[model samples]
Target: MDSGLGEGSSGYSTMDDYESLISTTDAELLKRAWRNEKAAPQILRYEAALVQRSREQIKLMEETVEEFTSSGVDPLTVSLYQMDLDRTLFLLRSYLRVRLQKIEKYMFHIRKTTELWNHLSRAEQNFAERCIEDMEQHMQQSVLSKLPSSYKSHLKQSSSSEEDDMVPEPKLDTYVICRSKKFLGAFQLDDRQFLSIQCHLLSWRMNSFIFLMSMNFWTVLKTLLTLKLMIYTLYLISL
Candidate 1:
């Protein structure tokens, strides 16, 4: 692997360094974003690079899996590689989704801040535009849109209201509930069932804690009794 380092230093040994560099870059971008700086351009650039790298990695892993299969490598080893590819794709998708979510959440501010838009690089502006369009299309196709007609009507009314000065930022609890619903649905469980399981788990944990504490209490009591007996025996011997 080239590691994208200088030619003299390009080797597998530098891959870790390259990873650290990318991680550091991401951290800096996130910090800027947290401070509400015009970091969209940098974020878009980083996102593009990461997406490209993920695609290349996925392709390479697929090729490697094919070669291993052809060479009659153990099924377990090939499966592990397949799992890695799956995880890579999952992470890539998650990364893009989160970026889009943030962009969407802050779209109102982005639009009103002329300086922010001006600060964006041409590539970043393009990415932002395309991302907005894609997010709208996705929402149209998503389960959210398929929700009850009443919900759809409510959304339409809220969106068309002219009196609203700005889009309200999503509540943290709402975001958490949305994510939790998706997570539960992934395992074919509803919120009620998930809650039941959570309660059961909590109860089990409490019971286990009580049992351990009781055992510890008995151990301490026994130790104290033994020490008292030894003290009494020592007094008798001294007498």
Candidate 2:
């Protein structure tokens, strides 16, 4: 979620919903993080605390599985526990793998961009640095070595280039399909422009309005009965 946006309203409606969300298991949190990372066009903020807790949980589960195996616990129970452990491991691994893929794909752009670079975890930052070093060396040997000195720079097409035009950056202008949990009416794009966004699936440019799609800002209000009824109808149709 974009920390820059003010907390207009929470996605959760009641104390019970908030409690339920906060009480979610680390495994579930990891799954959500994994899905979000996969769907996002650019890299997302690292879930450092959630990842650490998940790792600790995995270690404990591994030890428990080993003990259960040695003690000859019920076969079905042990198998179920093993399955849960495997699923959690897969989620964590997949999440990290997706981040690594994004880092690799945009290593040069990420390193040069402060906001994107700061979003990475320390380990991911190290990985990106190493990746940049390796890529530069490889480019020099395999491609840049044969080019003239003016075109030898890894991040530029030529020495005369104004910027790192050769670097691969994420496509912020790309349109994305997103859904909001709550109805946010008449979002202003500029001083004279506004867009009405009821609770529905929307297609918009990622660069222009990503903050509106943040889960944290999907706030609910009780003031729009007509809109609520329409949304309820849409939900029923969807079901």
Candidate 3:
């Protein structure tokens, strides 16, 4: 008699454990474990296709502008590629952000339902992680393109410019996220991480306005002081 089925069942405990293990890898199990709206393979494929087309268009624009004669991947053409890549990346990243937000909510429900930390099977987790990693890699490429050529890393897969790419490229910082429920503020756990909040950090227009206002105020103050000085000089001359 197995205790799993209350002393009367034979292999129920063993069967239960096996079922738990199988669910992680099984597509149906993954569907149940996944928090967000069921994302179809077709949707992911469609996103990939759009990204590919954007890349091709940029490459074509670059080639056409140069009549395909340029030996070097023109930096201008690279800019076009970087922009399209950035746009796609931004869209995908936003989607992931929304998903992550929802995950926190699903996590509580999943906790009550599943005994596992990683609810899905290892294979499924790996596949999802790979997709995330691909997005991160494209982001890295986008960052590198925007940076000065000298700042681009000499990766193992880099084409042809190993010699010029020699002068040690600058490294972007890694990110570490620390989830704190009590603090209620989302922030990087470590300063070592690169933050995507640069745009949100400060208002450029506000800073520019302050800079211009100060310049104008100083000019007016100087003009008023000069007029006062001239008036005093005339009085002194009259005396």
Candidate 4:
């Protein structure tokens, strides 16, 4: 499938061939995404249109990969789709990572805001701290939940590689999570006071951001999910 089952294979461009294989809507979505343009149904917000476009492309690509695999395409072809999807996912994940870093900064800001607020003499400080905690919790919840279910579940399933199938091994590192739990024990703040807010004001700003990223979050780059998607697509194609 990479070169092909053929006499004309030497003349073909892989990019062009694969482009044709893509669904027209997927192609349009991708084209617009790359162009970073605003277009129809306004399915994506103007600021996030490109990201949504890219995500739509991947979703459609996943569907196409499924169709190919199910049709009994050779492993080589499957490999191409896999690699293409992998690359796109890599980009998507990279974008998410960048956003996550921003979220991290904002989280720090939320803490810092209150930390500074805590330094104030009296009523103002308490009011600010309460606001900050409420904002932080809301921001965390919104970002965490907004990620696509299909993309998220797919990632969880595809955590390992085909190469790893060669050996039996413990799946996760024990220390990281354990250490995190320990860290949580050290921070003492009001839990309910942490939650309640009059308007959810500051957090709503963060919510807007999470809303934007949710439309474009890159869980697709996760190899495990990619593999699972491929296998599922293959099944669909076969049907």
Best by lDDT: 2
Model 2, 1-239: lDDT tens per residue?
A: 23323233333235435544653778767876787677665787798999999999899999999999999999898999999999999999999999999999999988988988998999899999999999989998999999989999988889999999999976543223333333342343321222233334322221123322222111221112212111111111111
Q: Write the per-residue lDDT of candidate 1 for residues 77-173, one digit (tens) a residue.
A: 9999999878776666555555555556655444445654564446556766876677557766884478765444322444456543434432211
lDDT of each: 0.42, 0.65, 0.33, 0.36
Ranking by TM-score: 2, 1, 4, 3
Ranking 2 against 4 by TM-score, winner? 2
Please give the range of 10 consecutive residues that has the lowest summed lDDT in model 1.
174-183
Best by TM-score: 2
Deviation of model 1 at 180, angstroms: 28
**TM-score of every model?**
0.36, 0.70, 0.21, 0.29
Q: What lDDT score goes with residue 201 in model 3?
A: 24
TM-score, predicted candidate 2 vs. hidden true structure: 0.70
lDDT, model 1, position 105: 64
Candidate 4 displacement at residue 15 in angstroms: 19
Candidate 3, which segments miss by more than 4 Å at Cα? 1-71, 111-239
lDDT of 3 at 18: 64
**What local lDDT does model 2 show for residue 98?**
95
Which candidate model has the greater lDDT, 2 or 4? Answer: 2
- Prediction 4 TM-score vs. true: 0.29
